[model samples]
Target: MEIKEKITLDMLTKDSVSVLRQKFITLNGEDVQVGGNVRNDFTNCEDDRKILKEQLSEDYYNAVMAVWEV
Candidate 1:
């Protein structure tokens, strides 16, 4: 069976950034790729992939925590 789905993130709020980033990493690793046209603030496909890999790396916890604060 073939299945498709769409998900959106409301990361505009400061408090949600960490959770959003974590969720983004999880979603990016799945079959779905991040999609949207919010040019000014969205992470492109390449960067998204890189970050996803980084999120699973040995330094993931520290890396994610650091980036989450930015």
Candidate 2:
């Protein structure tokens, strides 16, 4: 499924962790095999930061940062 809108790290404060996690997966096209896995858990701020910093592509990162800056 396609995401209706852009997502960002700021979503952590504005939306539920579950919602943000789903958006992250959608935006990044990640295959979530396990529901409760660490890679998909946005509740863990450290993990979220790591994914943003190390895993996500440049396009996705820039898109997220654009939303964050606004």
Candidate 3:
């Protein structure tokens, strides 16, 4: 799914320690399976960052165009 939104770190870290521990398990690929909550959160964060960056670049271009037009 495409994420066209922004999310704060606090929103992602609501579970704090539990989320970190779960992420560690999945990162280590330890036979201990971590649920989709952590995975989806990471995915959404990454996708949202990409979308935000694109939006920022477009805004920058528009601002530069306005300056050049002036």
Candidate 4:
């Protein structure tokens, strides 16, 4: 999957943690595994972020996004 979307809180709501986790890792350039650390990685990514936004509900998405933020 290609990336370059500068991930936003709203950009993460679809893919499973496993998928997102992989993305988080690739974008981060490390295996820190910390949500906050990985989350920042997505900011420089693209395609995947677009795909992730249409999967989860707003509430569920917010909860998931919150994990990466904090």
Candidate 5:
């Protein structure tokens, strides 16, 4: 059984940053790994990971919010 979930900008907008961070870990941790190494420690690039997550969250939030701009 395969259950696929799509995370959209609207979804991110509804969750707190902490929630989003957890979601990012569950869903995107592998995708964000350097060189796709499953054994790599995320802490090795903690600052980079934080920046990437923040950028993604902010980007999604802005995109969704833009829809309501008058």
Candidate 6:
């Protein structure tokens, strides 16, 4: 599917994790390419990941992780 509409952080909602994941991918993709923990050296962006997981809801963070699989 093609996402033509502009995706903004306003679209993020705790109402649905799956939906949030899709939106997250559309916006942030995966910040997992940098700053990841040494234990999880396979991918970077661990600090960012942790921040999101802490500041934002777990659902959105999980969504970010789902895309990190790529």
> Candidate 6 clashing pairs?
34-44, 34-45, 35-45, 35-46, 36-44, 36-45, 36-46
* Candidate 5: regions farther than 4 A off: 1-6, 10-56
Clashing pairs in 1: none
Candidate 2 vs candidate 6, TM-score winner:
6
Q: Cα RMSD for candidate 2?
A: 9.2
TM-score of each: 0.22, 0.33, 0.20, 0.30, 0.25, 0.35
Q: Write the per-residue lDDT of candidate 5 for residues 1-70, one digit (tens) a residue.
A: 2233334332222222222222222334353212221221222134634643565567554553354333
Between candidates 3 and 6, the TM-score winner: 6
Tell me how far the alpha carbon of residue 33 in candidate 2 is from the true structure, in angstroms, after superposition: 12
lDDT top scorer: 2
Q: Model 4: per-residue lDDT, tens digit, 6-44?
A: 233435433434323222334447433324323432332
Compose the digit string of candidate 2's lDDT tens values, residues 3-37: 33333333433222322323223435664332432
Model 1 residue 23 lDDT score: 15
Select the stronger candidate by lDDT from 3 and 4.
4
- lDDT of model 3, residue 17: 12
Distance from true location, Cα of 35 in model 5, Å: 26
Per-residue lDDT over 1-70 for candidate 6, one digit per residue giving the tens place of the 0 to 100 score: 2343221233333331222122211335632222222221112256655655665466645665666644
> RMSD per prediction, one decimal?
12.7, 9.2, 14.6, 12.4, 12.0, 14.2
**Comparing 2 and 4 on lDDT, the stronger one:** 2
Candidate 4: minimum summed lDDT over ten consecutive residues — where? 16-25
State the C-alpha lDDT per candidate: 0.38, 0.43, 0.33, 0.41, 0.34, 0.38
Enumerate residue pairs that collide in model 5.
none
Native-referenced Cα lDDT, model 1? 0.38
